[model samples]
Every structure is written in C-alpha cells, then in structure tokens.
Target: MVAIALCAIGCQNLSLPSASTATTPVVIKLSGWGSDPTEQKLLKQVLKDFETQHPGIRVKYEVISDQYMDVIKTRLIGEAAPDVFYLDALEAPFLMSQNVLEPLDAYINSEFDLPDFEETLINSFKYDNHIYGLPKDYSTLTLFYNKQAFATAGLTSPPTTWDELLTYSKQLTVDKNQDGRIDQYGYGVIPELARQAYKIKAFGGQLVDENGYAAFASEAGLQGLQLVVDQYQKDRTSAQKSDVGTNSGSEMFGQSKVAMVIEGNWAIPYLKETFPQLDFATAEVPTINDKKGTMVFTVAYVMNKQSQHKAEAWELISYLTGKEGMEKWTATGFALPTRQSVAQKLGYEQDPVRSAFLAGVEYAMPWQAGKHPAAIMNNFDNQFVSALLGQQPLKQAMQRAQAEANKLIRAME
Candidate 1:
C-alpha cells in the first residue's frame, strides 16, 4: 500500500511544471536611417531600457546608412524586412498604399494617449481613417540667419514677409572681392519639391488633383513658384548648394557663404558641432501671399505587415513613441518631439533657436501628397532647376514637368 501511494504522488508531480521555467523571449528587428553618433546613442539607450522593462523581448536595431527607402522597399518585396522601421512623411503616402505596413489603429489603446500628439503631425501619417504610423518627431523650415551678417548689413531683425525678404536679400548679398563672382549670397535655396511644396499650396494651388495626379502646373501653382524662380534668376540673391560648392544649405550658411538659410532642426546640432563660433538666430519663416506657410517634415514608426510577432512589434512601437521614450529621445534637442506634452515639458517652444520651429507648427503644411509623390517630385526638381537657371520659363517648365509626371502616374496606376 505504501509503494502504490508513493507512485501516485510521483505521477501527480509529473503533471505539474516547475516555477523556474519561462517562455523564450521573442526577437524583433527594427530599422532606420543612420544619424549622428549622439542621436544613435540615445536610440540605443532607449532600446536598452525597453529590453530591461520587457524581458520577454529582445530588439535588433539596424541602420541602413544610405538609400534607406530603396533598400527598405527591396527588402519588403523579398519578404525579409524588419519588424519595424522609420517611415518619412514624404514617403508615407506611397508606402501606406502598398499594403505592406501594419495598420496601428487596433493596437493603440487608451493608455497610449493618442490624442496627445499634434493633430497636424498625426494626420500626416493617417490614411483612409486608419493610423498607419505614429510620428516620432517633426521639424519645420525656419529662417536661420547669421547674426553677424545681419549686423553688418544694418538689419535689426529677420524679415517678416516675402516682400521684406526680397528687400533684405539685396542688402545682404555682398561681393567682397573686385571679381564679378559673389562672395556671400543673401540666401541659400534648396529648390527641391520637399522644400517648395508649401509655396505651391500658398496660392491656393493643389499639389495633386482629386484623382491624385500632378497638377502643380496650374496658373495658381506657377504664381507661388515664380517667387523662387525670380529670387534665383532675376534677384540673383540666392545660391544653391551646387553654386556654392557646398554639400547642403546648412553647410553654406555655417561657412558664411550665405547670410541666411531656410533649414530644419537637424541643422542645429550639425551647426553647433561643426561651427561653434557661428553666431546665428532663427525666426519663423517669412509670410508668403500674406499668409503664414512653412514645410513640416516628420517621420513615423511603422510596423511591417508580414511580421510574425505582431504583438511584440506593437509593444516596441508603443514604447519607442510613448511619452517617456519620446522625451528621452528628444532630450538632446536633436529632434523635436511630436507629442505636444513632451514639447511643452522640454520647453522647446521657449528656446530661442527652436521656438521659431514650434511657432510655425500651427500654420505649417505637412510635406506629403498622394501616392505618386516620388514621380511628381523627381520631375519637378529636374524641370524646376532648369527654370531656376533661366533655361525655361517657370510656367513652361512646370507644364512640361506636370505632363511627364502625370504620364508616369498613369503608368503606375
């Protein structure tokens, strides 16, 4: 009887598991474009803290140093993409329509405080009433002017309107040398679609038609863009990076090649690190057409539709874009937090350099259009440069570019 009782007890013990055993942790991969070392360090720290909090998951962070979107698209096509990745607002429309990104609406819960995000920034990533991505951070184009240059030019403050800017540019443009070539230009012009989209919208011009085709060749569109063309071709007060032999507009401004440059927040850290002695101040972008307008750029954290561990992926996205994580990431001021609460907590609105950007968020237009922006942007840049160089009229250049863009758009559809 004792042996039978002992055997029964052993059988019962075998049916139960030990408390020490735990399920294996899931590994989720994340990808983003490479940034400065400081930015990269902050991201790694955030990831580490997340790992500590959620022991059941490990994150694999990867940086695609160059051609990020092209590489990410290729990976997605091959079914070997990361679980989560950064999606720029400019590219968001195209990617969202691809049906490759996981819709995040169902995963977001009340605790996430979804309403805390700036509606303008949030809407940039929304499509068809679905939240495809959550903006991590955003920046608006602000007028960054060289203080010393301003003083030398006998100016007291930054230009307040487009007309004032043109007047200011003439005074700011200087040729120190006896040679015909200019030494310092009044402004550094990007002359790209990403930077010029707002100008198109300023004159009641739409970037696309109701059917999502390029329509910026309209009379209203050319009216706004003509301002840029006049500034470059007729005013001759602005110089592009190629003309200045610099890699970027910010660099030209930092090197004193231009008195002013319309740049985003990323230039702040770069200018501070590369040209600490440069005395510069930022102000809200000048008004155009008696209306406030500036281009707002943002990137969001999006999940892959093919991710095997959807729950784990959502957890990572939630944490990274959450209040605490966003605060930590934006602490260094490398990027502006998308969360209004976080921005207030950080006091970026009061910071002199960042204040200008914060102020423009209200009136800024998001830098995105319909699904065929890639085609639209490419054609516009190619033709707009010709117009800027005086090779073609603004209206004619836009007309030709729009026709080509619509042709490509039709092909894609």
Candidate 2:
C-alpha cells in the first residue's frame, strides 16, 4: 500500500531530520494566473482544506502575471517548475510537446470517476490519445449588460443578431454628462489575439488550416473579425481600446461605462464582488452573421513528468479532480465546473448565471493551443489591433496574421 505522508503548513519533506527545523514548508510549488483578492482567499481555503485532510504536504503558491509563458518555460526547462501548475487548453500543445507534463490517464482510470467528466473537457487535455491533465476550472464568454443602461435606452431584451446588436449598442450609448463628449460607450471589445478568437469561429472560420497551419485569413474570417472593429471605428458604438485602462471592457462594464461587453464567466464573480451596486446580468454573446458563439478558457491540473513524488502527486491529482475535491474547489462560485456530474451535483447547470455559462460550453471555440502560439499570437495581435485601430483593412490584417502565423508554424514543424 502506498503511504500517504501527513504534514502541515508547507510541502517540504518531513523525512529529513535537520530539515524539520527549517522555517520553510516542504515546498511543493503550484503556479497559476489570477491575483484577484477573492480568488486568492478562495484558494487559501482549498489549500487549507487539503492540508487539513492530507497533513504531510505544504504548498507554495505563486501567481505568474507578467511574461507568464517565458517564466513558466524557464522554470520548466530548468526543472524548477511547480509540482502542480495550471495548464491552459490553448498552451497544452506546446507544453505537452516539451515532454515535461506527465500523463495522468492511469491515475484517472485507477482512482477517480473516469466516466463522470464531460467529454469536451476531457478531450481538451488529450494528446496522442493520452491524458495529460485534469481541468480544474473553465470559462466561456457571454454578453454582460448593464440593466439600467438598457432600460434607459428603452430596450427590454438584449440583442440577438448582428444588425440588432449594432443598432442597440448605438441607442444605448450616451453622453450621460454631456459636456460635448460621449462618456458612456454602447459596447466594448478587447483588441488582443488571445481574446478575439471566438469572432472567427462564430462565423465558421477556422483559425488553423487543414494541416494545422494558420488559416484565419479567409474571406469569412475577415468578415467575422471586422464586424467588431467596424462597430467601434465605423459605427462609433463600441469603446476604443484606450477608452478604459488595462482591461477596458471589464473596467468599463464594472463602472457602467459600457452598456454591453463580451467577457467570460469569471467576470460574474468579479462584478458581483467589485461593483456590488451595479445592476448587471449576463446573456449568450451575440452572434456574427446571426450565428451564435464565444470562446473557452480553461485550466487543468497536470502532473510533472520528472516528479520524484509521482505517487503522492497522482494522489493529489486524483483527489483534486475527484468528486469531493472538485466540489470543494468549485464551491466558492469562482468558476464553472467542467464535469457534468459535478455540475449536476452542485446545481450549477441549472443556476441563472451558471446556466448561461453552461449554455455556451457546447458552442465555445477553444482558445488557440497550436505550437509556436506565442509567435502566432504576436503576429495575430499586432495585425488584429491594426484592424481595431482602423489602420489596416480587415482582409489585409487577417491575411498578414495568417501568413505570419503559418511561417512560424512551419518553422516549429
């Protein structure tokens, strides 16, 4: 029988004699994104709960905010990476290629509810027909609108089609404290490659070619992506990138500066906590050309291939993704449960905000995970931003993005 060592406060090995006196915990590092105070607090409770149940492990958690990929790559290459880290579905291809992430298929089969997970979530982590991780949380984009703003605009329901969205946005936009200036925006768009993925997919445009090369330069792709940009520059109903600092849309929505915005499920908790006074509700993100959809951003818990503590790590992974741990970890309303059984058990699939989140799961296009995504994203972001700023025709921008992405994609192959 494999022994489960019990320790507390930290993850340092208690087996060593003199090491026991060390102030630092037996450090098992965990890395992820998010420095939001509420998320951090929620994590603490989960960690504490883990320590309480399994006494021997001490976790040293770190949030990688800036140059995230570079830092993670450096640590992983140096073998100093965290024992448990967040693996995005988009970057799974790159990380899996590095041969660093351990396969957790056996663990899932042996210890957990193998059939209980949603097939869509399970398939995201599968590489070479092998499982690399267990998804801990997921977010799908939705249309968040300020209720009061809609009421003021004399609108009762949110827009459903592309034309209606444009008209509604223009109507809802106002110069509330008009000093010959427009203060409130009708809508907002995040002009980055990472966030705008759903635009292409919504209109049946593929981001990659049949051979898994960059393919977002198609006529359909340009049409889908341009619609959002046109709403800002041409239609004058969307917020410009510089209108709000940092996360323009999220911030604008929180302050009621934008009437409608496209953000993920995480934004719900954020708005609820940060701007409690704001009257906000969510709906499915409006479609392009009358087709409905959005994006998926998900993170999974992956095991370290070189872990000296594989047995222990597997135990943790199994338990963390198991019915009990998943229930506890997702209990705080921080994220949407990826497992169908868990969703059903928690009634998350039926809850208002959560149900809207759940509704979008089937339609959400996965965020890019192609190898050399950094280079591709760099090209895509620059070109896409050009379209957003009205500096380039949408066709030219996407063509440039697709060509650049293909070049980088070819080099990696």
Candidate 3:
C-alpha cells in the first residue's frame, strides 16, 4: 500500500563519521528508494545530527538504483543487509515473515508516544499483534479538483458521492479542439495494486480473508474495481493509467487535462511549483455509495534484530522519528506527519489544503502486508488490467487472480 514515489529528497548534507573504534561506529545501515534533492539533504542533516547526538555510533544510508527488490534480497540473503532499511506496507508482510525485520514493540514500549500515531497506519506494521516498525511519515488520499475546469462546467463544489462523480466528470470532460477526439479527461485513476485496493475496500471488498488468504473474487471486490474500468471504457470520462505518459495524477489535473484526481499531500508542493497558473483545491475523496474510506500508507525507522549495536540503532531511530525530527521534516509540507501531536502542532489539521487528507486518516485502511504481498500484487495487477480491457469478465479475471494467489500462498504455508 505504501508505494513510495521519488520526490522530495535532500534534507541536508550533514557529514557522518566513518565506522570507527573509540566512537566504535557500530554502523547501522539504512536502505530505501531514492528521495528528492531536498529530502536527501534533510536526511543527511538528520543523520549528522544523530551522529553528533550519539557519538558512540555511526549511521550509513544506501539506495538501490534498479531491480530494487532483487538488490535488497540479494544483500539480505548474503547476510549483508542494512541494519535499518525502509519497508513499505505492501512489502512488509513478506519481509517480516522471513524474520528479516526486528519487532519494535519491546523497544517502543512506554518511552515513545505510540498512541499518538495514526491508528490506521500503526496497525499496518503489526503481524499477529507484534509491532515491527514505527511510521516515520504518513499520508491519506483526497480529491484534487481543477478550479477552472469546475467553473467552466458551471459547478461550484466538487462531488461527494460516486454518482455525482460520474455526473461532474461528464460535464467537465471536453474536446477542446473538437477535431474528433477528447482533449481533456473528466477524471483519472492509477490502476496500480495500491490504488485499486483502495477502491476494493471503498466498495466493501477485501483482498484477502482474515486468515491472510486471497479473497478478491467476491462480488463487492469485482464491482468496486469495475467502476474504474467502466468509466474509462464505456463512460469515456476517465483516462487509462498510462494515457498521461509519465505525468502523475497531480500533473494531469494541474494541466487541466483531468478535472479531478485522488492524490495525497506530497503533490501540493509540486503543483505549486510546476503549474503555478492552475487554480486547484483539495476536498475529501468522494464516498462510494454511502461509505467513506481511503487507503493509508506509512514508513518507519526500525532496528535490526541481528544488529550487535541495537542501543546505538535505537538512538538514531528514536531521535529521527521522535517529535523534534518529525516536526522538522514535515515543516516544508513535503509529507504529512504520522504523529497526531506533530500534525496538530504544524496546524495541518486546520489547513484547507491538507484538511481532506487529514480527515481521511480516521477511516483509511492500511495497505495489505505479510509474506507473498508483492507476488499477490504482481499477479492481481496483470489480471486486473486484462479485466479492465474487456478481455475477460471482472469475475473471471479476479477469480483467476484469486486462485493463483491462493496457490502461491498455500505453498508458502
């Protein structure tokens, strides 16, 4: 569920000391996707601050360029894994089951404000009630509407229901040049596993049973996802995930090519910088029927169970994810803080631009986790796309995916 995108890097360029003897740099290695220039700078500064605060330990950061999983898996299998690496909600289950992640429950205990983090996000890292990680940053989904497009369609506020979404989309969509084809799409959705999974829940479907087995062939699941495909294939109001090339949902909405998009807090800065001419506003994601829900994803700094210097690792984890560090990192509005205290202190709960995302937290479900999460996703996405293209009925496509996922999961069991 936590599909980290590449943006907001370079926090600060604080220098870290090499693995040493007196300071006895018990190097704690951290791994994750590449970040934006600014985030990277800020992170480096944070690490340097960690080093200065705990002169007894040293921290190292590593990022994979390509085939990221393969690289991490190779290192892990060879026992060359990072002491602290990033884990997404979608990928956590598999890694945690393999005993790759250290359970943070004992470490977290009463010292940290565990209850202050978003409940939806906190539970994502829990397997069998054993906590494995602490969320460093978190975000929730919201509706981003292009104000000009809304005014052009004679609409004031964005829709709050599925039916209204369809109606507004039809009104906002247009063929500007009018040669023959449509120049602007009314709405769009990224058909990735994470986004589609959000849709599945919104429509009262669960991807897997409570026992952690596949169950996406259910009526609610298929109907939920079919809504997305039908809008594009039949209603002609939404664009295919790939139709916009490399432009993100925010980019498309900002260009006025799409009237509405369900995006997160991270895109606000990009929109302000890349498309300053566009007028936009954020609203809570529309309800499906009468239910209101969204997907929540998070990441945390976790210590390695196998590390000889856990005390040192916890020192960094504690500082970086603590109130002070989280507050500084979220100061630029790059991401929404997971802590309720940080969120309140930053006034994100009151800002209109962030209100919807903040509100979504109360109902947003965590992205699925556990062993076979990636495989489950890979198989579902392929069959889901086939269903979207009409090559197979929604039921059959999902059944096929469900069957395959069950087979894979059973083998592991």
Candidate 4:
C-alpha cells in the first residue's frame, strides 16, 4: 500500500509543467516617431528578430506620428510612458536633467562594448556622468548637387569652399524658357536654426551662452549668417521651400527646382526611391570660414525610469543598438550606424556618395542647443526667415530673436 501511494505522487508531479516553461512573456512598450515606410519596415523586422531570439519578451512598438516630443513629455509626467522610447539628441539635455529617464550605466555590461559607439554620438546622451541613452544612429549634413546641372553649368567638381559654392550657384541659376519667371534656382535653403547652427559656429558664434541663454546675436555670428542672407536677398540665387512650392529641400532638389541643397543621409534613399531619374551626387559640405563644419543629428534609445520590467526594457535597447542589430538596421543606408564596428562592417566610409557624410562627422557639431532649445530655435528661425525675405536687416532680426529667446528662457526658469 505504501509503494502504490508513493508511485501515485510521483506520477502527479511528472504531469505538472516546470516553472520556466509555464512563465508568461514580459511585454515591453517601445515608441518612436513615424519614419519612411522602408525604415518602419526595417525596424519592425529588427523587432521581430529580437523576439525570435528572446522568446520570453515581446516588444509592443508604437509610432507617434506627430508632435512626438510633446506627446512623450506629457506621457512621462503622467507616468504612462513606454518602457523604452526614442529620444532626439536636441531634446536629450532637457530630459536627462529631469530625472525621469533611467540611467543605463548599471544595466550595461562590458561585453555590450560601449566603446564601439562613436564618441561624439555617445557623449550626447551622457549627463552628470550618467549615460541615459544609447545612440542608435546618426546623420551628418552633406551637399547634394545635381550631376546634370553641374554638366550644364560646365562645372567639373563640387564646390570646395562657400565662396566657390556661391559662384557655382550664380552659374547654375537659370531662366530656361525666358518667360521672365525664373525656372530653376541654384540653391535650396532651409532657413531654420537647426540647419544653420554649424554656420553660426563657423564664425565663433554660439547658439547659447554658458548659462544657457540665447547668445547667437553677436557680431561674429552675423558674419556667417550674412552669407546666407546675401545669397537669398542680395543675389536671389537661393529659394526657400515655400518659394518653390515644395515641401522640403530634398524635394526642391529632386524636382530640379534647385540645383544644389544641403541635406543628410535620409535624403539619399528618399531621392532614389521617389525621383529615380534624378542624377545626384553628394560632397562634403563646403568649408565655412575656411574651416570644416557640418551638423550631426542623432537619436538614442532611452529607458523609462518607471518601467516595471526594467530588465526587459534594457534587453530591447541593447539588442536594437547592438552591433548585429545596428548593422541590419543601417544596411539599407536610410540612416548611418552609430557603432564604429557597424559602420566599418557596412563600409559606408568607402561608399562613393556616403563617404562625404562619414568624413564630415569628425568636424560636425551635434545638433543640440541648451535645455530650452525650442525657445531659441523658434525665435531665431522666425526672425532669420524675416531677414531672408528682406523684411528686416540681419543684425536687427538676430538681435530681436536673441532678446525674445532669452526672455522666454527667463520666464521658463
């Protein structure tokens, strides 16, 4: 009777499942802004691969199509933010200072190879010696020129200096049909503070003071900006997107409304897929003030401090920003890899068109303003556009912009 009872107990134990096999998968909420369809598809595939490798964790990806930063900020305040999300470098300073993001230092292990990422990009997410985010990818501005336009203008090479670029612009501007209205402009200009930050730095001008106040109205700043103003108001060789009835600089260039434009890596896939017939080539942005300069824009994957599944969140971030995942993400050339190993493995430096962008990274200025970036960016862009339209003098416009931005920053404080 005792042996039969023991045998019955053993049979019951054998019928039950193990704890590990019966455990439910943790779901991580991941969020980012909407991108091109191809980029979105690639990201989805990466997530799928991550799930395949990590069957115990599933990522619930969400795309906030518009006002991404505003939505994220609101969600963070309500403690309803995703476990992991994308953060732009421009907005990193503010959020990193807010103590809402998880400091990733503890979660990172040596095998993760933090040193593999580009120093410039990685440093952007570091604040107070704590790494809050890991940069996923970066893009540096490059000058994109129409090859057919160059041939028509009898130009053998892209401009090597800003002066040469202006000269080339004059030659490329044309009134093809002689209808009195200009058919094509030489350059497409984006009169926004983000695109012009490097130009401001070209002449020792800065976007903000040591205390983070607006400081871009100095005499040195105007020198670099005057070049842009002169091209638009004085020479009339440059056209804003609105002037050409186009939506963006890339569109203006791709549609042949402008012969040249300064754009980033995203424009390459866009131009190729959208305007397949356009013959375009990219070159390092022409030197400004006899110094090499361009803007580097980067985005990082960050963790929410309030996440219930912190380990699962880090797993998603590490996998997405890891070498293997970065290689797969950047393989399409829609964006450049932030990891040096991935960049080397992909060989973007050897690519004929992409090489220009890669070369500019060494001298590129990260696209970050102070903690209060929107105030400075908005005021400067509004006034700069006014100056470009001859509505006001450059000096006065910038001065007004600087004062207004500083006033807003003070109010925020």
Which candidate has the top score in lDDT? Answer: 4
Q: By TM-score, how accurate is candidate 3? A: 0.90
RMSD of each: 10.6, 6.8, 6.5, 10.6
Candidate 3 yields a Cα-based lDDT of: 0.77
How far off is residue 356 in model 4, in Å?
A: 1.0
Residues 308-340 of candidate 1 have per-residue lDDT tens digits of 777888889999899999999898899999999
Q: Model 4: per-residue lDDT, tens digit, 233-343? A: 889999999999999999999999999999999899889989999999999999998999999999999987777788788888999999888998999888899988888
Ten contiguous residues with the weakest lDDT in model 1: 12-21
In model 3, the runs with Cα more than 4 Å from the true position are 1-25, 244-246
TM-score for predicted model 2 compared with the true structure: 0.87
lDDT (C-alpha) at residue 208 in model 4: 97
What is the TM-score (0 to 1) of candidate 1? Answer: 0.92
Q: RMSD in Å for candidate 2, one decimal? A: 6.8
lDDT of model number 4: 0.90
Q: Which candidate, 1 or 2, has the higher lDDT?
A: 1
Candidate rank order under TM-score: 4, 1, 3, 2
lDDT of 4 at 185: 94
Q: How far off is model 4, as Cα RMSD?
A: 10.6
Root-mean-square deviation of Cα positions for candidate 1 versus the true structure, in angstroms: 10.6
Tens digits of per-residue lDDT, candidate 3, 188-281, equal 7777777777678766778878778887778887777888888978998998646866467877777777889888788898899888988999
Task: Write the candidate numbers in order of decreasing lDDT.
Answer: 4, 1, 3, 2
Name model 4 segments beyond 4 Å from true.
1-22
